[model samples]
Target: MTDQRWAGVRQRVEAAGAGPGSGEVFGAWGHKWVVEEPLTRGELAELEAQTGVRLPEEYRAFLLHVGAGGAGPAYGLFPVRRVRGRWRWEGDGADLADLSRLDQPFPDQGPPRKLLDDLLAQRPEEEDFDEIEDFDDAIEAWDERWEAVMFTPERTSGAIVISHLGCAQREWLIISGSHRGTVWSDCRVDDADLVPLLDDDAVPVRFDRWYTDWLEGAERTALSAP
Candidate 1:
């Protein structure tokens, strides 16, 4: 099933690449391609083994049949090899996944909004400020707990970042748990919750559906546009 779907997607992409205005479509629109050769079955297996997790079917199909990286939404897809290092947001002191935990089941429930509000409300009142050092100490303790809750992977457990969509937007592929194979967008910095990408029918879109939808649109737009 995955093979057939992927083949159709590739056909559409290749047909579009040959169409008029393809350059404009790729350059200006959401679609682009680094167009590397696909990975072999052995390579795919090695990646799963190293991560201690099974690759979701469609995503595994993507890495094996599509380009091994390069050319995807926003900044393009992340190569399997690139996932091992600290993520892009790690330097910002944001909580994020370490390579060791990528295979673990993503937490079933995300931290609730009310819980976050409560934590923020816990900030020491100004009247509680006694000595300068005491206030500083109190603040630091609060910051630690806040950061931990904010960064904990419970909400996004069993997922790995697949693309950095710029502006703190990102795409993650869930690898473990019930949501495995589903793709989600991380837009929390914008005060938005992580959202699942859905197809036209409102079904949760997996990697292949998401990728092909983008490809099909790019083709049609390029061929039809003036």
Candidate 2:
């Protein structure tokens, strides 16, 4: 059944690659619509065993039937590779995922709304400071607090970063707990908390939908390129 669903995925990606302006898409230069080799069942098992968590089923099938990773949304999916006999994913900010804690439930909420708002409110404005050095010092202290709240490992437990959108933005695939199988947007770089990617109906987007939507859009962009 999974095989049936994933049928032609590689072909579709290839067809999209043939489009004249495909390279014009944001982050296309990184992957160039090139899908990597799929993983064997044994390799997949090894990865799961090493991580101590089963990957979302849809994404698992993708690694088996489509590609391990490549030519995805934004800059593209981070490719998982064997490094020095250990499996790990490679890409910008990929290290942000705490693989050792993949079994934990991804926190439903980040720091309290009031706390975030207070921190933002406290962000130093250069115009308010008589001395530039004072402004820099104030902003630096505020940033440390903000980072402590936003970038902690507990915030993203059970998630694997799947793609980097550049500028410190990325997407996550939830691998455990209630939200497992959903794709989430990471916009903490822009001072927003991680949120689930939503479909047109406002439902959370799953791994398969996220990839296929990007693939379809990429194909359209490619085919329409002049």
Candidate 3:
């Protein structure tokens, strides 16, 4: 997708009270970006079926109505982050970057790792959809339903794992349990906790202007930490 498409969406999001990406709460590392689509039940099922990841209850609830733009949860807005400060990341999924390696690492992984795996993939074919070229395109198409990560024990040399979403960290979450018994839960990014990450005087930048400023020097010091 062209940057033009995202540019329009970004403006619409900011106009709709979305904040630029900040390290605030569920904000991405640097610039804040709005989630392209608000997740729904039908969408959720599609993602689960495709990735074989049973999303966490909290996340599923959040997706159903929370944090989405316009007075709902899944409130798509990720806060804009600052240069340098002390921040604490807690939870089992916090440093789980290496976990994606536990996956089968292919497009159409055959089945999960249980007897149910065969049963799960046994459903008859439905209407087909064309796959996109990459993540950005998938987002542009508002195709978040296909967003899932799948891995297996024999393939990953361990257990089965999955994630309902994928991000830049090379991170993959296990939405469901693995045959080897790995399970995951997502931690909420609390505002009371995130506010302290910034100095008392951190200022907001125009959504259009923040990302460049972030790339120039604002994020340098922040990225220094793990």
The CA root-mean-square deviation of candidate 1, after full C-alpha superposition on the true structure, stands at 5.7
Q: Give the local distance difference test score of model 3.
A: 0.31
Residue 60 displacement in candidate 3 (angstroms): 1.6
Off by over 4 Å in 3: 1-31, 67-170, 178-226
Better by TM-score, candidate 3 or 2: 2
Ranking by TM-score: 2, 1, 3
Best of the candidates, TM-score? 2
What TM-score, over all chains together, does every model reach? 0.73, 0.97, 0.27
lDDT of each: 0.67, 0.91, 0.31
- True-vs-predicted CA distance for residue 84, candidate 1, Å: 11
Per-residue lDDT for 166-185 in model 2, tens only? 88989999999899999999
Ranking by lDDT: 2, 1, 3
Question: CA lDDT of 40 in candidate 2?
Answer: 94
Assess candidate 1 and give its TM-score to the true structure: 0.73
lDDT of 1 by residue, 74-154 (tens): 555666553464222221112354556767786666678798778868976657887888888898888787767766656
The superposed Cα distance between candidate 3 and the true structure at residue 2, in angstroms, equals 34
